[model samples]
Target: MRIIHLLVIGALVFAAAYVYRIKMDSTARTERVLRLHAEIREQRDAIAVLRSEWAKLDAPLRLQGLAERHLPLKPLNATQYDSLKNLPERPPSLVRPGDPDPIGAMIQTIDASADASSVTGSVPTSAPASEGQQ
Candidate 1:
Protein backbone atom coordinates (compact mmCIF):
# COMPACT_ATOMS: atom_id res chain seq x y z
CA MET A 1 0.00 0.00 0.00
CA ARG A 2 2.89 2.46 0.69
CA ILE A 3 4.49 1.67 -2.74
CA ILE A 4 1.19 2.40 -4.48
CA HIS A 5 0.92 5.78 -2.76
CA LEU A 6 4.52 6.75 -3.78
CA LEU A 7 3.82 5.88 -7.47
CA VAL A 8 0.65 7.94 -7.42
CA ILE A 9 2.48 10.95 -5.95
CA GLY A 10 5.24 10.69 -8.58
CA ALA A 11 2.67 10.67 -11.41
CA LEU A 12 0.90 13.70 -9.99
CA VAL A 13 4.16 15.67 -9.73
CA PHE A 14 5.05 14.89 -13.43
CA ALA A 15 1.57 15.92 -14.59
CA ALA A 16 1.82 19.23 -12.74
CA ALA A 17 5.24 19.97 -14.31
CA TYR A 18 3.89 19.20 -17.82
CA VAL A 19 0.90 21.46 -17.31
CA TYR A 20 3.12 24.34 -16.10
CA ARG A 21 5.40 24.02 -19.16
CA ILE A 22 2.42 24.11 -21.49
CA LYS A 23 1.04 27.23 -19.84
CA MET A 24 4.38 29.04 -20.14
CA ASP A 25 4.66 28.17 -23.84
CA SER A 26 1.11 29.43 -24.46
CA THR A 27 1.90 32.73 -22.73
CA ALA A 28 5.10 33.26 -24.78
CA ARG A 29 3.21 32.60 -28.02
CA THR A 30 0.49 35.06 -27.02
CA GLU A 31 3.09 37.77 -26.32
CA ARG A 32 4.72 37.17 -29.72
CA VAL A 33 1.34 37.44 -31.45
CA LEU A 34 0.63 40.75 -29.75
CA ARG A 35 4.08 42.10 -30.74
CA LEU A 36 3.51 41.16 -34.37
CA HIS A 37 0.08 42.82 -34.34
CA ALA A 38 1.64 46.04 -33.02
CA GLU A 39 4.27 45.97 -35.77
CA ILE A 40 1.56 45.51 -38.41
CA ARG A 41 -0.41 48.47 -37.07
CA GLU A 42 2.71 50.67 -37.11
CA GLN A 43 3.44 49.67 -40.74
CA ARG A 44 -0.17 50.42 -41.72
CA ASP A 45 0.02 53.88 -40.13
CA ALA A 46 3.30 54.62 -41.96
CA ILE A 47 1.77 53.54 -45.27
CA ALA A 48 -1.24 55.78 -44.70
CA VAL A 49 1.01 58.76 -44.01
CA LEU A 50 3.05 58.09 -47.16
CA ARG A 51 -0.11 57.77 -49.26
CA SER A 52 -1.44 61.09 -47.97
CA GLU A 53 1.89 62.81 -48.74
CA TRP A 54 1.86 61.33 -52.24
CA ALA A 55 -1.67 62.63 -52.80
CA LYS A 56 -0.63 66.11 -51.76
CA LEU A 57 2.39 66.04 -54.08
CA ASP A 58 0.30 64.78 -57.02
CA ALA A 59 -2.46 67.42 -56.75
CA PRO A 60 -3.34 69.02 -60.12
CA LEU A 61 -2.81 72.58 -58.85
CA ARG A 62 0.67 71.71 -57.56
CA LEU A 63 1.53 69.98 -60.85
CA GLN A 64 0.31 72.97 -62.87
CA GLY A 65 2.35 75.38 -60.77
CA LEU A 66 5.46 73.20 -61.16
CA ALA A 67 4.93 72.92 -64.92
CA GLU A 68 4.49 76.68 -65.33
CA ARG A 69 7.67 77.37 -63.35
CA HIS A 70 9.95 74.72 -65.02
CA LEU A 71 8.52 74.02 -68.47
CA PRO A 72 8.41 76.22 -71.62
CA LEU A 73 4.79 75.24 -72.46
CA LYS A 74 2.15 77.97 -73.06
CA PRO A 75 -1.59 77.83 -72.29
CA LEU A 76 -4.16 77.44 -75.08
CA ASN A 77 -5.44 80.59 -76.88
CA ALA A 78 -8.58 81.11 -78.97
CA THR A 79 -6.47 82.09 -82.00
CA GLN A 80 -4.53 78.82 -81.83
CA TYR A 81 -7.57 76.79 -82.94
CA ASP A 82 -8.12 76.07 -86.64
CA SER A 83 -11.08 74.94 -88.82
CA LEU A 84 -11.01 71.35 -90.18
CA LYS A 85 -11.56 72.64 -93.72
CA ASN A 86 -8.27 74.57 -93.55
CA LEU A 87 -6.29 71.27 -93.39
CA PRO A 88 -4.41 70.28 -96.58
CA GLU A 89 -5.51 67.34 -98.78
CA ARG A 90 -3.85 63.93 -98.29
CA PRO A 91 -0.76 63.18 -100.37
CA PRO A 92 -0.80 60.57 -103.16
CA SER A 93 0.15 56.94 -102.51
CA LEU A 94 3.87 56.09 -102.42
CA VAL A 95 3.40 52.89 -104.48
CA ARG A 96 3.94 53.12 -108.27
CA PRO A 97 0.87 52.88 -110.59
CA GLY A 98 2.00 49.61 -112.24
CA ASP A 99 2.96 47.74 -109.05
CA PRO A 100 0.54 45.11 -107.71
CA ASP A 101 -0.46 45.17 -104.00
CA PRO A 102 0.49 41.73 -102.56
CA ILE A 103 -1.84 42.26 -99.57
CA GLY A 104 -4.85 43.03 -101.79
CA ALA A 105 -4.17 40.03 -104.04
CA MET A 106 -3.95 37.73 -100.96
CA ILE A 107 -7.25 39.14 -99.55
CA GLN A 108 -9.05 38.50 -102.85
CA THR A 109 -7.69 34.93 -103.12
CA ILE A 110 -8.79 34.17 -99.52
CA ASP A 111 -12.30 35.54 -100.16
CA ALA A 112 -12.68 33.46 -103.36
CA SER A 113 -11.38 30.29 -101.65
CA ALA A 114 -13.76 30.79 -98.67
CA ASP A 115 -16.74 31.20 -101.01
CA ALA A 116 -15.81 28.06 -102.98
CA SER A 117 -15.34 26.04 -99.80
CA SER A 118 -18.77 27.18 -98.48
CA VAL A 119 -20.50 26.09 -101.69
CA THR A 120 -18.82 22.64 -101.47
CA GLY A 121 -19.75 22.25 -97.76
CA SER A 122 -16.05 21.90 -96.72
CA VAL A 123 -13.73 24.26 -94.85
CA PRO A 124 -10.47 25.39 -96.52
CA THR A 125 -7.64 24.23 -94.23
CA SER A 126 -4.78 25.73 -96.29
CA ALA A 127 -2.54 28.37 -94.68
CA PRO A 128 -2.68 32.06 -95.79
CA ALA A 129 -0.77 33.07 -98.99
CA SER A 130 1.75 35.18 -96.96
CA GLU A 131 2.68 32.19 -94.76
CA GLY A 132 2.58 29.60 -97.61
CA GLN A 133 4.81 31.73 -99.84
CA GLN A 134 7.34 32.17 -97.03
Candidate 2:
Protein backbone atom coordinates (compact mmCIF):
# COMPACT_ATOMS: atom_id res chain seq x y z
CA MET A 1 0.00 0.00 0.00
CA ARG A 2 1.10 3.59 -0.58
CA ILE A 3 2.00 5.90 2.35
CA ILE A 4 -1.04 8.16 1.74
CA HIS A 5 -3.47 5.15 1.75
CA LEU A 6 -1.92 3.76 4.98
CA LEU A 7 -2.15 7.19 6.71
CA VAL A 8 -5.84 7.51 5.70
CA ILE A 9 -6.61 4.01 6.96
CA GLY A 10 -4.92 4.71 10.31
CA ALA A 11 -6.81 8.02 10.68
CA LEU A 12 -10.10 6.20 9.93
CA VAL A 13 -9.37 3.59 12.61
CA PHE A 14 -8.50 6.27 15.16
CA ALA A 15 -11.71 8.15 14.39
CA ALA A 16 -13.76 4.94 14.73
CA ALA A 17 -12.18 4.19 18.12
CA TYR A 18 -12.76 7.76 19.35
CA VAL A 19 -16.41 7.64 18.21
CA TYR A 20 -16.89 4.28 19.93
CA ARG A 21 -15.44 5.64 23.17
CA ILE A 22 -17.75 8.66 23.05
CA LYS A 23 -20.77 6.44 22.35
CA MET A 24 -19.95 4.18 25.28
CA ASP A 25 -19.42 7.13 27.62
CA SER A 26 -22.77 8.65 26.58
CA THR A 27 -24.54 5.28 27.08
CA ALA A 28 -23.00 4.94 30.55
CA ARG A 29 -24.03 8.47 31.50
CA THR A 30 -27.58 7.88 30.19
CA GLU A 31 -27.87 4.71 32.26
CA ARG A 32 -26.58 6.56 35.34
CA VAL A 33 -29.11 9.36 34.81
CA LEU A 34 -31.93 6.79 34.45
CA ARG A 35 -30.79 5.06 37.64
CA LEU A 36 -30.69 8.36 39.54
CA HIS A 37 -34.20 9.20 38.28
CA ALA A 38 -35.45 5.82 39.49
CA GLU A 39 -33.86 6.46 42.90
CA ILE A 40 -35.49 9.91 43.07
CA ARG A 41 -38.88 8.41 42.19
CA GLU A 42 -38.50 5.81 44.90
CA GLN A 43 -37.48 8.46 47.44
CA ARG A 44 -40.47 10.60 46.49
CA ASP A 45 -42.78 7.60 46.93
CA ALA A 46 -41.23 6.93 50.35
CA ILE A 47 -41.67 10.59 51.31
CA ALA A 48 -45.33 10.42 50.25
CA VAL A 49 -45.84 7.33 52.36
CA LEU A 50 -44.14 8.99 55.34
CA ARG A 51 -46.25 12.13 54.95
CA SER A 52 -49.50 10.05 54.85
CA GLU A 53 -48.38 8.18 57.95
CA TRP A 54 -47.57 11.45 59.70
CA ALA A 55 -50.97 12.86 58.78
CA LYS A 56 -52.69 9.81 60.25
CA LEU A 57 -50.56 9.97 63.40
CA ASP A 58 -51.03 13.72 63.83
CA ALA A 59 -54.80 13.79 63.22
CA PRO A 60 -56.61 15.75 65.94
CA LEU A 61 -59.44 13.23 66.26
CA ARG A 62 -56.96 10.34 66.75
CA LEU A 63 -55.01 12.26 69.38
CA GLN A 64 -58.24 13.31 71.12
CA GLY A 65 -59.47 9.71 71.19
CA LEU A 66 -56.15 8.54 72.64
CA ALA A 67 -56.18 11.30 75.25
CA GLU A 68 -59.74 10.43 76.22
CA ARG A 69 -58.86 6.76 76.56
CA HIS A 70 -55.55 7.26 78.46
CA LEU A 71 -55.86 10.58 80.32
CA PRO A 72 -57.93 11.00 83.48
CA LEU A 73 -58.88 14.63 82.76
CA LYS A 74 -61.72 16.23 84.77
CA PRO A 75 -64.02 18.98 83.51
CA LEU A 76 -63.54 22.43 85.04
CA ASN A 77 -66.04 23.86 87.61
CA ALA A 78 -66.79 27.46 88.59
CA THR A 79 -65.29 26.78 92.05
CA GLN A 80 -61.84 26.07 90.42
CA TYR A 81 -61.38 29.85 89.90
CA ASP A 82 -60.70 32.20 92.85
CA SER A 83 -60.56 36.00 93.20
CA LEU A 84 -57.14 37.66 92.72
CA LYS A 85 -57.01 38.53 96.45
CA ASN A 86 -57.13 34.79 97.38
CA LEU A 87 -53.95 33.92 95.42
CA PRO A 88 -50.66 33.26 97.27
CA GLU A 89 -48.01 36.01 97.41
CA ARG A 90 -45.09 35.79 94.97
CA PRO A 91 -41.80 34.54 96.47
CA PRO A 92 -38.80 36.86 96.87
CA SER A 93 -36.05 36.67 94.21
CA LEU A 94 -33.12 34.36 95.14
CA VAL A 95 -30.68 36.69 93.34
CA ARG A 96 -30.55 40.36 94.35
CA PRO A 97 -31.02 43.07 91.71
CA GLY A 98 -27.44 44.49 92.04
CA ASP A 99 -25.57 41.17 92.43
CA PRO A 100 -23.23 40.00 89.63
CA ASP A 101 -24.64 37.01 87.72
CA PRO A 102 -23.64 33.84 89.69
CA ILE A 103 -23.68 31.51 86.67
CA GLY A 104 -21.60 33.96 84.59
CA ALA A 105 -19.05 34.25 87.40
CA MET A 106 -18.71 30.43 87.55
CA ILE A 107 -18.28 30.18 83.77
CA GLN A 108 -15.60 32.88 83.82
CA THR A 109 -13.72 31.10 86.63
CA ILE A 110 -13.81 27.80 84.67
CA ASP A 111 -12.56 29.45 81.47
CA ALA A 112 -9.69 31.18 83.34
CA SER A 113 -8.67 27.89 85.07
CA ALA A 114 -8.66 25.72 81.88
CA ASP A 115 -4.94 26.04 80.92
CA ALA A 116 -5.13 25.28 77.17
CA SER A 117 -2.17 27.62 76.48
CA SER A 118 -0.09 24.73 75.16
CA VAL A 119 -0.73 21.27 73.66
CA THR A 120 1.28 18.07 74.28
CA GLY A 121 1.68 14.87 72.13
CA SER A 122 0.72 16.91 69.06
CA VAL A 123 4.18 16.61 67.50
CA PRO A 124 7.47 14.74 68.08
CA THR A 125 10.85 16.49 68.52
CA SER A 126 12.64 13.59 66.79
CA ALA A 127 11.56 10.85 64.41
CA PRO A 128 11.25 7.31 65.83
CA ALA A 129 13.55 4.59 64.51
CA SER A 130 12.12 2.18 61.97
CA GLU A 131 12.01 -1.60 62.51
CA GLY A 132 14.98 -2.13 60.17
CA GLN A 133 17.04 0.45 62.09
CA GLN A 134 16.24 -1.24 65.40
Candidate 3:
Protein backbone atom coordinates (compact mmCIF):
# COMPACT_ATOMS: atom_id res chain seq x y z
CA MET A 1 0.00 0.00 0.00
CA ARG A 2 2.82 2.43 0.86
CA ILE A 3 4.54 1.76 -2.41
CA ILE A 4 1.33 2.37 -4.43
CA HIS A 5 0.60 5.66 -2.62
CA LEU A 6 4.14 6.96 -3.32
CA LEU A 7 3.84 6.12 -7.03
CA VAL A 8 0.40 7.83 -7.26
CA ILE A 9 1.76 10.98 -5.53
CA GLY A 10 4.76 11.15 -7.87
CA ALA A 11 2.46 10.81 -10.96
CA LEU A 12 0.20 13.60 -9.67
CA VAL A 13 3.21 15.97 -9.13
CA PHE A 14 4.49 15.26 -12.65
CA ALA A 15 1.03 15.95 -14.19
CA ALA A 16 0.79 19.27 -12.27
CA ALA A 17 4.21 20.36 -13.54
CA TYR A 18 3.17 19.60 -17.16
CA VAL A 19 -0.04 21.64 -16.78
CA TYR A 20 1.94 24.61 -15.37
CA ARG A 21 4.42 24.45 -18.28
CA ILE A 22 1.55 24.43 -20.80
CA LYS A 23 -0.04 27.50 -19.16
CA MET A 24 3.26 29.39 -19.21
CA ASP A 25 3.76 28.57 -22.93
CA SER A 26 0.25 29.77 -23.78
CA THR A 27 0.84 33.06 -21.89
CA ALA A 28 4.11 33.65 -23.75
CA ARG A 29 2.39 33.08 -27.09
CA THR A 30 -0.37 35.54 -26.17
CA GLU A 31 2.20 38.19 -25.25
CA ARG A 32 4.02 37.66 -28.54
CA VAL A 33 0.76 38.07 -30.51
CA LEU A 34 -0.01 41.33 -28.67
CA ARG A 35 3.46 42.66 -29.42
CA LEU A 36 3.01 41.92 -33.13
CA HIS A 37 -0.36 43.64 -33.17
CA ALA A 38 1.18 46.75 -31.61
CA GLU A 39 3.98 46.75 -34.18
CA ILE A 40 1.46 46.52 -37.03
CA ARG A 41 -0.42 49.51 -35.65
CA GLU A 42 2.81 51.54 -35.49
CA GLN A 43 3.66 50.70 -39.10
CA ARG A 44 0.18 51.73 -40.26
CA ASP A 45 0.56 55.13 -38.55
CA ALA A 46 3.95 55.68 -40.18
CA ILE A 47 2.53 54.84 -43.59
CA ALA A 48 -0.30 57.32 -43.08
CA VAL A 49 2.20 60.07 -42.29
CA LEU A 50 4.25 59.27 -45.38
CA ARG A 51 1.16 59.28 -47.59
CA SER A 52 0.11 62.69 -46.26
CA GLU A 53 3.56 64.13 -46.96
CA TRP A 54 3.50 62.71 -50.47
CA ALA A 55 0.15 64.29 -51.17
CA LYS A 56 1.43 67.67 -50.03
CA LEU A 57 4.49 67.39 -52.24
CA ASP A 58 2.38 66.35 -55.21
CA ALA A 59 0.08 69.41 -54.98
CA PRO A 60 -0.21 71.01 -58.44
CA LEU A 61 1.00 74.50 -57.43
CA ARG A 62 4.01 73.18 -55.57
CA LEU A 63 4.89 70.84 -58.42
CA GLN A 64 4.58 73.69 -60.95
CA GLY A 65 6.90 75.95 -58.92
CA LEU A 66 9.44 73.17 -58.59
CA ALA A 67 9.32 72.54 -62.34
CA GLU A 68 9.77 76.25 -63.15
CA ARG A 69 12.80 76.52 -60.83
CA HIS A 70 14.62 73.33 -61.85
CA LEU A 71 13.51 72.81 -65.47
CA PRO A 72 13.21 75.10 -68.51
CA LEU A 73 9.41 75.02 -68.47
CA LYS A 74 6.99 77.93 -69.01
CA PRO A 75 3.25 78.33 -68.74
CA LEU A 76 1.69 78.31 -72.19
CA ASN A 77 -0.21 81.42 -73.41
CA ALA A 78 -3.00 80.50 -75.81
CA THR A 79 -2.83 83.71 -77.89
CA GLN A 80 0.98 83.63 -78.23
CA TYR A 81 0.99 79.95 -79.18
CA ASP A 82 -1.74 80.43 -81.74
CA SER A 83 0.24 83.24 -83.43
CA LEU A 84 3.53 81.28 -83.50
CA LYS A 85 3.26 80.73 -87.26
CA ASN A 86 3.34 84.53 -87.83
CA LEU A 87 6.69 84.98 -86.11
CA PRO A 88 9.32 86.72 -88.35
CA GLU A 89 12.45 84.96 -89.55
CA ARG A 90 15.72 86.38 -88.14
CA PRO A 91 17.88 88.20 -90.75
CA PRO A 92 21.66 88.48 -90.71
CA SER A 93 22.97 91.76 -89.24
CA LEU A 94 25.05 94.28 -91.24
CA VAL A 95 28.71 93.66 -90.30
CA ARG A 96 30.76 96.80 -89.59
CA PRO A 97 34.52 96.88 -88.96
CA GLY A 98 35.73 96.95 -85.29
CA ASP A 99 32.18 96.42 -83.97
CA PRO A 100 32.31 93.92 -81.03
CA ASP A 101 29.20 91.96 -82.03
CA PRO A 102 30.34 88.67 -80.58
CA ILE A 103 27.26 86.59 -81.44
CA GLY A 104 27.07 87.88 -85.03
CA ALA A 105 30.79 87.34 -85.52
CA MET A 106 30.58 83.79 -84.20
CA ILE A 107 27.68 82.98 -86.55
CA GLN A 108 29.52 84.47 -89.58
CA THR A 109 32.73 82.63 -88.72
CA ILE A 110 30.94 79.26 -88.38
CA ASP A 111 29.06 79.79 -91.70
CA ALA A 112 32.22 80.83 -93.54
CA SER A 113 34.17 77.86 -92.15
CA ALA A 114 31.39 75.44 -93.15
CA ASP A 115 31.21 76.82 -96.69
CA ALA A 116 35.02 76.70 -97.09
CA SER A 117 35.15 73.15 -95.71
CA SER A 118 32.49 71.95 -98.17
CA VAL A 119 34.20 73.64 -101.14
CA THR A 120 37.80 72.60 -100.35
CA GLY A 121 37.85 69.16 -98.78
CA SER A 122 41.63 69.45 -98.01
CA VAL A 123 41.56 72.81 -96.16
CA PRO A 124 43.49 72.87 -92.83
CA THR A 125 40.68 74.60 -90.91
CA SER A 126 41.79 73.68 -87.38
CA ALA A 127 43.96 76.23 -85.51
CA PRO A 128 47.40 75.05 -84.23
CA ALA A 129 47.64 74.72 -80.45
CA SER A 130 49.75 77.38 -78.71
CA GLU A 131 52.30 76.43 -75.99
CA GLY A 132 50.89 77.36 -72.57
CA GLN A 133 51.48 76.41 -68.90
CA GLN A 134 48.70 74.27 -67.41
Candidate 4:
Protein backbone atom coordinates (compact mmCIF):
# COMPACT_ATOMS: atom_id res chain seq x y z
CA MET A 1 0.00 0.00 0.00
CA ARG A 2 2.86 2.43 0.72
CA ILE A 3 4.46 1.55 -2.64
CA ILE A 4 1.25 2.28 -4.48
CA HIS A 5 0.98 5.66 -2.71
CA LEU A 6 4.56 6.52 -3.70
CA LEU A 7 3.86 5.59 -7.31
CA VAL A 8 0.74 7.76 -7.34
CA ILE A 9 2.72 10.67 -5.89
CA GLY A 10 5.43 10.28 -8.55
CA ALA A 11 2.82 10.27 -11.29
CA LEU A 12 1.22 13.42 -9.93
CA VAL A 13 4.59 15.18 -9.82
CA PHE A 14 5.31 14.15 -13.43
CA ALA A 15 1.86 15.36 -14.53
CA ALA A 16 2.43 18.70 -12.81
CA ALA A 17 5.82 19.12 -14.43
CA TYR A 18 4.41 18.33 -17.87
CA VAL A 19 1.55 20.81 -17.39
CA TYR A 20 3.99 23.50 -16.20
CA ARG A 21 6.22 22.93 -19.22
CA ILE A 22 3.22 23.20 -21.54
CA LYS A 23 2.07 26.41 -19.86
CA MET A 24 5.55 27.93 -20.12
CA ASP A 25 5.78 27.00 -23.79
CA SER A 26 2.37 28.56 -24.47
CA THR A 27 3.42 31.73 -22.64
CA ALA A 28 6.60 31.99 -24.75
CA ARG A 29 4.59 31.53 -27.93
CA THR A 30 2.12 34.21 -26.82
CA GLU A 31 5.00 36.64 -26.19
CA ARG A 32 6.43 35.90 -29.63
CA VAL A 33 3.04 36.52 -31.22
CA LEU A 34 2.70 39.82 -29.39
CA ARG A 35 6.19 40.83 -30.56
CA LEU A 36 5.31 40.01 -34.13
CA HIS A 37 2.13 42.05 -33.87
CA ALA A 38 4.07 45.04 -32.59
CA GLU A 39 6.61 44.66 -35.37
CA ILE A 40 3.83 44.52 -37.93
CA ARG A 41 2.25 47.62 -36.47
CA GLU A 42 5.61 49.45 -36.60
CA GLN A 43 6.08 48.46 -40.22
CA ARG A 44 2.57 49.63 -41.06
CA ASP A 45 3.24 52.95 -39.39
CA ALA A 46 6.48 53.31 -41.36
CA ILE A 47 4.64 52.56 -44.57
CA ALA A 48 2.03 55.20 -43.79
CA VAL A 49 4.75 57.76 -43.10
CA LEU A 50 6.49 56.91 -46.37
CA ARG A 51 3.24 57.14 -48.29
CA SER A 52 2.51 60.56 -46.82
CA GLU A 53 6.01 61.75 -47.71
CA TRP A 54 5.58 60.43 -51.24
CA ALA A 55 2.26 62.22 -51.53
CA LYS A 56 3.90 65.49 -50.50
CA LEU A 57 6.71 64.99 -53.01
CA ASP A 58 4.36 63.99 -55.80
CA ALA A 59 1.82 66.83 -55.41
CA PRO A 60 0.99 68.19 -58.87
CA LEU A 61 1.41 71.84 -57.80
CA ARG A 62 4.93 71.14 -56.49
CA LEU A 63 5.85 69.25 -59.65
CA GLN A 64 4.44 72.03 -61.81
CA GLY A 65 6.38 74.66 -59.87
CA LEU A 66 9.59 72.67 -60.21
CA ALA A 67 9.00 72.16 -63.91
CA GLU A 68 8.32 75.83 -64.46
CA ARG A 69 11.47 76.82 -62.60
CA HIS A 70 13.81 74.36 -64.37
CA LEU A 71 12.34 73.35 -67.73
CA PRO A 72 12.41 75.34 -70.98
CA LEU A 73 9.14 76.98 -71.97
CA LYS A 74 6.79 75.14 -74.34
CA PRO A 75 3.22 75.80 -75.58
CA LEU A 76 1.63 73.95 -78.50
CA ASN A 77 -0.24 75.61 -81.35
CA ALA A 78 -2.38 74.26 -84.19
CA THR A 79 0.16 75.60 -86.74
CA GLN A 80 2.79 73.11 -85.48
CA TYR A 81 1.03 70.12 -87.09
CA ASP A 82 1.47 69.05 -90.73
CA SER A 83 -0.77 66.94 -92.98
CA LEU A 84 0.01 63.18 -92.96
CA LYS A 85 0.60 63.29 -96.72
CA ASN A 86 3.40 65.78 -96.19
CA LEU A 87 5.27 63.31 -93.98
CA PRO A 88 8.36 61.63 -95.42
CA GLU A 89 8.07 58.08 -96.75
CA ARG A 90 9.03 55.22 -94.41
CA PRO A 91 12.70 54.25 -94.62
CA PRO A 92 13.54 50.92 -96.26
CA SER A 93 14.05 47.93 -93.93
CA LEU A 94 17.68 47.31 -92.96
CA VAL A 95 17.39 43.52 -93.14
CA ARG A 96 17.99 42.28 -96.70
CA PRO A 97 15.91 39.44 -98.15
CA GLY A 98 17.22 35.81 -98.13
CA ASP A 99 19.78 36.50 -95.41
CA PRO A 100 19.72 34.69 -92.04
CA ASP A 101 18.80 37.17 -89.32
CA PRO A 102 21.96 38.32 -87.50
CA ILE A 103 20.07 38.71 -84.19
CA GLY A 104 18.57 35.23 -84.57
CA ALA A 105 22.00 33.75 -85.32
CA MET A 106 23.47 35.37 -82.21
CA ILE A 107 20.51 34.18 -80.12
CA GLN A 108 21.00 30.62 -81.44
CA THR A 109 24.71 30.78 -80.54
CA ILE A 110 23.89 31.93 -77.00
CA ASP A 111 21.22 29.22 -76.68
CA ALA A 112 23.77 26.58 -77.75
CA SER A 113 26.23 27.88 -75.17
CA ALA A 114 23.52 27.79 -72.49
CA ASP A 115 22.72 24.20 -73.39
CA ALA A 116 26.39 23.29 -73.04
CA SER A 117 26.60 25.00 -69.67
CA SER A 118 23.45 23.19 -68.47
CA VAL A 119 24.96 19.69 -69.12
CA THR A 120 26.31 19.37 -65.55
CA GLY A 121 26.00 15.56 -65.45
CA SER A 122 27.44 14.83 -68.88
CA VAL A 123 30.79 14.35 -70.69
CA PRO A 124 31.91 17.93 -69.97
CA THR A 125 33.25 16.96 -66.53
CA SER A 126 37.05 16.81 -66.09
CA ALA A 127 38.33 13.24 -66.09
CA PRO A 128 40.42 11.90 -63.21
CA ALA A 129 44.18 12.67 -63.43
CA SER A 130 46.42 9.77 -64.39
CA GLU A 131 49.00 8.33 -61.95
CA GLY A 132 51.98 10.12 -63.53
CA GLN A 133 50.21 13.51 -63.36
CA GLN A 134 49.52 13.07 -59.67
- Which predicted model would earn the best lDDT? 1
- Residue-level error in angstroms, candidate 1, position 94: 13
lDDT of each: 0.84, 0.81, 0.77, 0.83
| Residue-by-residue lDDT tens digits, candidate 3, 1-134 | 99999999999999999999999999999999999999999999999999999999999999988988899966677765646577798787775665656775575577566755374544355533122111
TM-score of 1: 0.57
Off by over 4 Å in 2: 90-134
> What stretches of model 1 exceed 4 Å from their correct place?
76-134
Candidate 2: give the clashing pairs. Answer: none
Query: How well does model 3 score by local distance difference test?
Result: 0.77
TM for candidate 3 is 0.53
lDDT for residue 24 in candidate 2, whole number 0-100: 100
Query: In TM-score terms, which candidate is top?
Result: 2
Best-to-worst order by TM-score is: 2, 4, 1, 3
In candidate 1, the residue pairs with backbone N, CA or C atoms under 3 Å apart (3 or more residues apart, or in different chains) clash, namely: none
Model 4 scores worst on lDDT over the 10 consecutive residues at 124-133
Q: Tens-digit lDDT track for model 2 on 1-134?
A: 69999999999999999999999999999999999999999999999999999999999999999999999999999999999998899999888888766776785566556556532545332444232233
Displacement of the residue 63 alpha carbon in candidate 1, Å: 0.9
**How well is each residue in 1-134 modelled by candidate 4, as lDDT tens digits?**
99999999999999999999999999999999999999999999999999999999999999999999999979989999999999999999788887667776775566456755575564333544232234
